[model samples]
Target: MSINNDDITPSKDNEIREPMYGMSINENPKERNPNSSNKLLGVFYGIGMNVNTIIGSGIVTTPGIIWNLVKSPIVVLLLWFVGGIVSMAGSLSYVELGVIHKISGGETKYLQTAYPQPRIMMSYLFSFMHIFAIRPGIISAVLQSAAQYFWYTLKEHQYDDGIDINTNGWKLPFTPFWYVKLLAIAFLLIITAYHMFNTRWAIYINQTLAVIKLITYSIIAIAGIYRLFADWPTSRTNWQNSLNGNSDITAYSASILLITFSYDGWNSLNYSLDEFRKPEKKLIFSNSISVGIVILVYLLINIAFISVVPAEAILDNDKSSYETIAVVFFYKLFGQSPVTVRIFTALVVLSVIGTAATGIWSLFGVHLLSYSLEVIRYRNKGNLKKEKNDKELNEKSDRSSKIEYEVSLFFVGIFILAGLFILIFSFMVHVECPNYNPNCSLREKRIEQMSPMLISYGFLIIALLFYLFYYCLDTLKRQREAKIIRIADK
Candidate 1:
């Protein structure tokens, strides 16, 4: 078994580019830290990344959808609270597996490590689904919402219809069909370009946007609370009706899907565990803190939404949920001034853009994992030749810059194509929906367009359950193995 000397040596860049026991998404040239022992990030960074990734279009748009289905503010709140719990549970599970495997891939690493028979194929399938269906679907949905708001702001100003100044801000009397969609595609492309080329700038932009989003949310929450108590007519009947609407298992299930979507990224920080200073302790702490913070943020935001906007209004907001229920709530607070609406709409755009950026950034972690697994055959081979073969492959790979660039481009191309395909499909679906329902509202059409994405999440949830089950079995097996080793030694 000849070891690759180049593998052990630093490159011309004076940095080692080896994947740890796992590869992380943070392997870009500028971002790579050579010293493995150096821990750079703290709990706050983790929380910021997690929140940015989790609280996107779902929070802004899904509340109305949930209210439309669940019809109970209390149940919706409970479901969101429960979603946080589920997220925390998932985070804890990831921490356990991450500590042991210490891999860069998120769920892909979990599946690869936990499943018996070493379902490498399943991991590949997961990567395929993630790049094709899951990431693009959700991202397109988010971009669509942001674009809709952006367009809404423009159209309101352009049309200048006789909108009541006392009720709602100036709104477009009708949707701008191709223009809004082209704007959405442009939004997606800008985000993709930012991440694909200027990742450092993208990170800075992401962090700044996250801070702005939190502050905006705080302002919204405080204003809503003030209105609820100080100004808005206090109606116990309104509160009761919100909490006592008709409950159905199906409704709860659908609401749970969206709620969990809002809470989905809590475990994202675990993918970069190697970056943490004291990963064993810090990973768990950061994840727990982040999830707790998300729960608080989510609950407060929902509370604010319900307080300022009545439940009936939210349920009937089928037309403009694609924009934001909060826009209407803010309209009620700040009056019908176009400036207020534009500022609020612009904030929503920035917030969702941050989310899309974080999500795309986090996705590369799984891609890195998949790439690492693809290159390191010995990890799963369980044979004596594993190291020698991997070493040979590493040497060949190290010598060839062109091959690596080609591979990188190949993956990047795949992602871009998938994104474009989904974006086009979203617009096509929007254009064609009227054939089925002549009077389909924008929010309803948006949801209809998002159906494929919801289905993708459904598949992801099933995969998550599979991981949990296998993780338990893997844990027990390890425990049993330790027990046997101890007995034999004794």
Candidate 2:
């Protein structure tokens, strides 16, 4: 129970300190570096993280399911707004806790403090680690998606000369697993380099991606709406009919849930609480604007998608919701030449890379934070090298010596562990599908295989355990402190 509770409290029969959590690290986390306040990316950096978290494969995948479930174009656009409100509320709640905690583990950190018990802790631990211990699957999905778009882009390039770009040309070297591993390594390397060398650069990249994503989504949405109006569908319904339309009650309930996930990233800025100049003001601004912007973009994008691709086709064919919709709309309108389809796909892919990179970066922070905690205990009171080193080195080297060791150990461990965790998560997630006909797109397979347990269980379990453990420790600390105060008054 020294000033910092980064680690647990000391185990003693009687100690005159607040019973804290965890133990043993020398480094001052707060003192890592003088944050270079970026004048250019002040607000936009948070926006980037927001967009990055939300716009992953979700955009490409979720919209199709939504299209299938809610066919009305008006409801398709409106659902995004509803999703935004719920997620934004969660973001606001986090901002309040984030200031109180002021650490990077985001909601996970708060849950640990608030819950902190055995059963609850274990469940959350299992799922949390399972999902993002490394993020191999997520990274792979992004890369695989990127490659698809890349292949299509190559087709566009080949079109000017009237040569059919052999889609199979790159297929041999780019096996699914191989491409995933490569993209995982590549994105990790890029993010690591940015964060380690300069965080400002990382934020800058996040912001730039956010801006681009916002603009592209807006344009696509506007374009879609205009096109639909130009040739209004024989079946057009305003908000009243769209909401109460024959769309099944169960379907709308599901759409409500799905759209919520689609706009899941409104609170991305909460994770970067420490890095913010004035997190309090920033959180309000960042979360508010981020949710608003995402909802707007998502609404428009879906409107565009449905306007082009009939709902029935989208429902029947789960593969390629956004892209297929785009192809139908753009090709029929722009002439189904190979070039135009390629161009549209290129934009979608380009837009999502920055989105994917941001997610990798955020998940990386989770490992880094948890690893830092682990390092503190791994060093065991920073006594490892102290046993071997001279009194001179130990004394003059200062309290931070232990911290340096922990930090070093943290990065090394996370890299290895993260990679392995990702592989396992990916495999488990893969199993959600029994037979993968090598012909089926991995994307569709993943959607089919996705387990809702992946998202909800971890948070639920962690919240419970985290509350219990911290409650006992906090209660004991308070009683002990009160006794000490009484003695002093005497």
TM per prediction: 0.68, 0.61
lDDT of model number 2: 0.54
Candidate 2 runs further than 4 Å off: 1-44, 118-148, 155-208, 233-254, 311-324, 336-338, 378-490
Model 1 alpha-carbon drift over 4 Å, by segment: 1-39, 116-119, 157-175, 235-237, 243-247, 321-323, 378-490
Worst 10 residues of 2 by lDDT: 158-167
User: Candidate 1 lDDT, tens digit per residue, 1-490?
Assistant: 1112211211211223344433332234224445534445676777677777777877887876776667766877888887776677666666655555444567776665445244354665587678667777777777877776676576643221243212222243343544666787998888889888887788788889898788877887787677667855653344567544355664565576667667767767756654655455567777778888878888887777777775556544225542367666767677668788778878887888888878778788877766665455434332333445455546655653221111134434543553354344443332122234456466664566576767877777776676567667856976887689799999
Candidate 2, residue 402: lDDT: 34
- The alpha-carbon deviation from the true structure for residue 322 of candidate 2, after best TM-score superposition, in angstroms, is 5.7
Instruction: Please report the candidate that would top lDDT against the real structure.
Output: 1
Clashes of 1: 0
Q: Candidate 2's residue-wise lDDT over 282-381, tens digit each?
A: 5666666777777677766776666655544454332443433444555555664777676766676666677666766666546655555444433443
**Relative to the unseen true structure, what is the C-alpha lDDT of residue 472 in candidate 1, on a scale of 0 to 100?**
79
Clashing residue pairs found in predicted model 1 = none
Model 2 error, position 255 (Å): 3.2
